[model samples]
Target: MTDSLAIDAAETVDGRDQERGSDFARLSRRIVQAGLLERRHGYYALRLGLVAVCFVGGWAAFFAVGDSWYQLLVAIFLSLVFAQVALVAHDLAHRQVFRSRRSSEIAGLVAGNLSIGMSYGWWMDKHTRHHANPNHEDHDPDVAPDVLIWSVEQAAVSRGLSRFLGPRQAFLFFPLLTLEGFNLHVASFRALSRPSLRNRGLETALLVVHVAAYLAALFAVLSPGKAVVFLLLHQAIFGVYLGCTFAPNHKGMPMLRGAERLDFLRRQVLTSRNVSGGRVVDTVLGGLNYQIEHHLFPSMPMPNLRRAQPIVRAYCEELGIDYLESGLFSSYAQALRHLHEVGAPLRARGSVADPASSK
Candidate 1:
């Protein structure tokens, strides 16, 4: 394995690299020939229609149920519905549903800011950086040390909540994710202060309207106590659902160290792990189960990703690059194991676990 990696590194040197500039070009040609790059307008239309029906139906049910505990069930249903809306917003952000940026952003604002109360502009900037460098410790915001440490170096310097959670993070990961929805809301509101965010006025207005309308609906129908419970439960379920959907994509994959570079194909392929499943998994994850394919072709329509998978896998195999895929549960286990390993040292010392000690 070490020798193969050494050979891979050597092949990447001096611009003579077989897979540097030309490899992705070739793969892209194959993908285009397969017609996988074409937009799936019909698919998006059907999907958006179903999503709208669910969204409207969920709210209608919420009103019909009134101030009862049964509303919690409605909350669960709506959380799932909201997640689907966010997925549509994700496709819009990637331009998978629209050819023009203006069209995509207009749809994105409605799906994100108005429908979901997430700031599309803020998420786009962050998501773009993540796609540019999927698992780079320095560059990918998704992998950066925060409430949970992703690397030994990060574990060593861990402070505050991260330090407290490091040793037990794997166990607590899902529980912590219950707060992810709330965190996203806070981050969206906070990002309005950043001067780099475009359409600041429009973004703020949409978000404010969403919050005001959502709160008013809850309080007007349910008692204050039930409304608060409904709000917290809905957001918590949404957070957990979103986190679970994304965590399996790159969490346990190889992390690119400082200044380590690869051609675009290897950069994305080596750092992503796909979850193998059928249509149900595809729907649940919004096509993110095909993480490798999606990373390789960010603009590819979600429905087209499955068709592109075999072509991509065969090409990677031909080039002697690893293409990782695992069963859905196996992927989660790998991610949790990685979390456990990263905190091994702190667990031993009764301080923060040292990510290196597990090695």
Candidate 2:
């Protein structure tokens, strides 16, 4: 699956397999000439070292705090650390840090399965589809009919919990994300039974180690009640943090429908959004704030995404494309507004139905 994804990524270069005068081919030439796709081993080495220290130090503090309620503070800190670790895993899966598949997968396994208890294979497969067709309702799992519906068409046919949640999802979005961490763990374990997942034995072993160690550490240091609370708090924070980091990238951007064919440049630029921010925002969002550039060149180094922004934006303007970049809070607002609009039909239906039947 990683190899396949790499193949998909490679097709972006000089717009291979594309016709002459391809817009993406021209853009690719500029990006290549600007040296945006080069590997950044030094930056990654320092980054990985710092993250390793923080991860280990956070746990050391957790044990040091012993049975104190102050351990809750440690839980919050660790959850933030875990999100950062997951971001590292994201880069690894993109092969941004490592040029070789073997090296990337090895580090991805450590960062994803062992450290975070999420399946690298599972996430890679899903993310690969997302990149291949960003914001396509039919193809992008991110916008598929899940607990929250992303389109009115999906909402119109929603049933069971999805139906119940659809109308209020905008209001409930953040609260629901509190469980996203747990959902990821459950999804990872469940996906292990699938026949297509690579390295099944090793992935399972790493995941089991992560789960066992995580639970044992909590219970060994604190009472059962306190341990449970710490676990919940940690997972909740992790979920919300992770959700926030990703939600701004494409939530309110254009949605591609079935049979809608677009050139590579338009498909990526039109459906993706950029969040306007500086270095701190870049770090917090894991450089995903530059969504347009990242989707265009998935394997581009994170720091280089920042530098490539101006060139990409100018090129989009030259082509008369509506490049969307929004302030952080405005982006969230736009996403929530889109969610609300998606559920308008459900809201109207409920309002006109018999009151008792509605309950």
Candidate 3:
């Protein structure tokens, strides 16, 4: 099934490229000349300012709660703030918020490492590869071996715990994401510990400060029980929030095998899905609802994604390429369904195995 799907997708791409080989590059240049690539300073200032105010407000509330059960509420608010700040860090990593690479790096470090206890260098290295090859089995870190088996090929190779979990992954996906916040912090620390990583000392120091300050503030303001609960709530919600925003982008989209070659536009569009919603959804998602547009132009500012959507969609339609967009709920459902489908064969095989063989 996986091989057949790969062949069909590859054939579609080859056919499309023959008809519209240079259209993507030409359209990209036109979009650039039309100022879609320009930064919106005012928009970014408003967003950054709002994030800062919410972050400070959340911390202030945490201190004021003072041993009350309201500390839990404050923790939830803090998670939202952290998610928003992380989105800003995402934009900075893409160099979408600033023209100067150094300025963007500074902003990313401050938001990712200092504020959110993640390593910016680590995230940038992984995310750049993801953007370049959105859903490539070998190249995209987002779909690499993790708690989820994104492709049937991956499911086929599963063993031990992964094999046990593979058949049930769709059912367990969201619950597993509750651990993602914790997982990301661990990954960041591990990345920083690599001997080959540059500026490792500074990244380590920033992570330490974030951890110490985050813990001290909770311990200082809440009872021991409340503090423990608060930490769990904060991290779990943070994980879910992050997963919700990102899972809709590429989870159900086409997966590229390592051997397939595709043109720039075909690769981006085919491997990306967009969520259809209004401003509230857009703001919550940090404009990531426009995943198709963002994947095509990674460095386009967040605000510009909405504007680029119609043009990109029309272009894809004219070229007879698939342009996928769905409501938030529908997108998630599709992703879950895709996971279930991928695991179906493994699940059937597992079901037929002898009970004595398990031992």
Tell me, by lDDT, which candidate is best.
Answer: 2
lDDT of each: 0.88, 0.90, 0.84
lDDT against true structure, model 2: 0.90
Task: Please give the lDDT score for candidate 3.
Answer: 0.84
Report model 1's TM-score to 2 decimal places. Answer: 0.92
Q: In model 3, how many backbone clashes occur?
A: 0
Best by TM-score: 2
Candidate 2, superposed: residue stretches over 4 Å from native = 2-11, 14-21, 355-359
Q: How well does each candidate superpose onto the true structure, as a TM-score? A: 0.92, 0.96, 0.92
Give the per-residue Cα lDDT of candidate 1 at 237: 97
Q: Residue 296 in model 1: shift from native, Å?
A: 0.5
**Model 1 misplaced stretches (Cα beyond 4 Å):** 1-20, 351-359
